[model samples]
Target: MGDDASLTARKAQLRKECLAARDGVGPLRRAMAGTRLYARLMGLRGRTIAGYLPIGSEANPTHAMRVLARDNRICVPVVTARGAPLRFREWWPDCPLEKGAFGVPVPTEGGWRVPDVLILPMVGFDAGGGRLGYGGGYYDRTLAGMGDALAVGFALEAQRVEAIPQERTDITLPYIITDAGVFGADGTV
Candidate 1:
């Protein structure tokens, strides 16, 4: 085979691997475990927390009922309007939820507020804190203005890239938590 053909084959193989890894249920469970551990380590008790609904390799804490059961205020993002910014609404475990844009679960009606901590999902991330999302830019755009809020991205250890594909608008996560551990300014504590 030619060089181009070999490179193309390699790219295809990587895409297949990523899809398989992202689709597996085991990775989600592991990542969720990592997220819960970090939440406690970060002293997240009683703080307002926001988490996105995971679609792929992104960690999904939705199953961790304990986090919601705790005394913290929980918020989730809802796609209110196209070409508009994301709006986060306060949510509770028992609160009624409806499917918003892209089929992501969200609160139907409420006021928006900034969260003390934001647990984000990513398709890929790196040690330098770079994150590649699902291309919607919702989390990135939403967290951009949150200077005082802790921005954390959750992922499986497998999703860690050597480095993320850089772009002008890409925001760095202050904390990147994987099943193995957490990284960034907090230094894995």
Candidate 2:
């Protein structure tokens, strides 16, 4: 098979594995415990962070939410329009969030804000630190101007691969939190 075909098959298989793994929150907890992510994230000051609510088998952010809310200004992604960058809305554990377009939750009452730290979810990621979102380019465009924002992708060890298809517009994660450990762009474990 060609590269595209192989990638499609690999993604489908990995998606299934990830979903199963996320179904039980125990792994997420253990992963977070094994890594120094909590300490690192908790250290951020004056940071406006954006974290997405995990859907399907995507990297679960259930645990990260509590730490983030206590440490920094936490925001969530709200889908506004197709082909447009994502608009962020302030989010808290008890905050009322309505299911917006594309079935993702959006804050019911608040204006938008740009993120200083972006915590992204991935279906599959490569050892090269490339990301495969839910086939959306929203994060890529949103991070274009916010170069100062720290980009972090959360995923499972099973989702890590040798490489994934990437476009010129694709943005990479500087840090990745996983069940195994926190990895940098150089594939350091």
Q: Which parts of model 1 have CA positions greater than 4 angstroms off? A: 1-17, 25-42, 63-65, 185-189
Q: What is the C-alpha lDDT of each candidate?
A: 0.68, 0.74
Off by over 4 Å in 2: 1-36
**In model 2, how large is the Cα lDDT of residue 10?**
69
Clash number for candidate 2: 0
Residue 115 C-alpha lDDT in model 2: 86
Tens digits of per-residue lDDT, candidate 1, 33-142, equal: 56654554455567778866655455666654245547677788777777565777887666777877887877766657678788777676678888776666777777
TM match of model 1 to true structure: 0.77
| Candidate 2 clashes between residue pairs 3 or more apart in a chain or in different chains | none
Give the per-residue lDDT of model 2 (tens digit) for 1-189. 487777667666766655565565565464663354565577786678888876665665756776778767888888788988888998888788778877776789766778888888776677667887766678888888786888888877766667766667888788888777788888887
Find the candidate with the highest TM-score and give its number: 2
In Å, residue 81's CA in model 2 sits off its true spot by 0.5
The best candidate in terms of lDDT: 2
Model 2 residue 6 distance off true place after TM-score fit, in angstroms: 8.3
Per-candidate Cα RMSD to the true structure, in Å, reads 5.1, 3.1
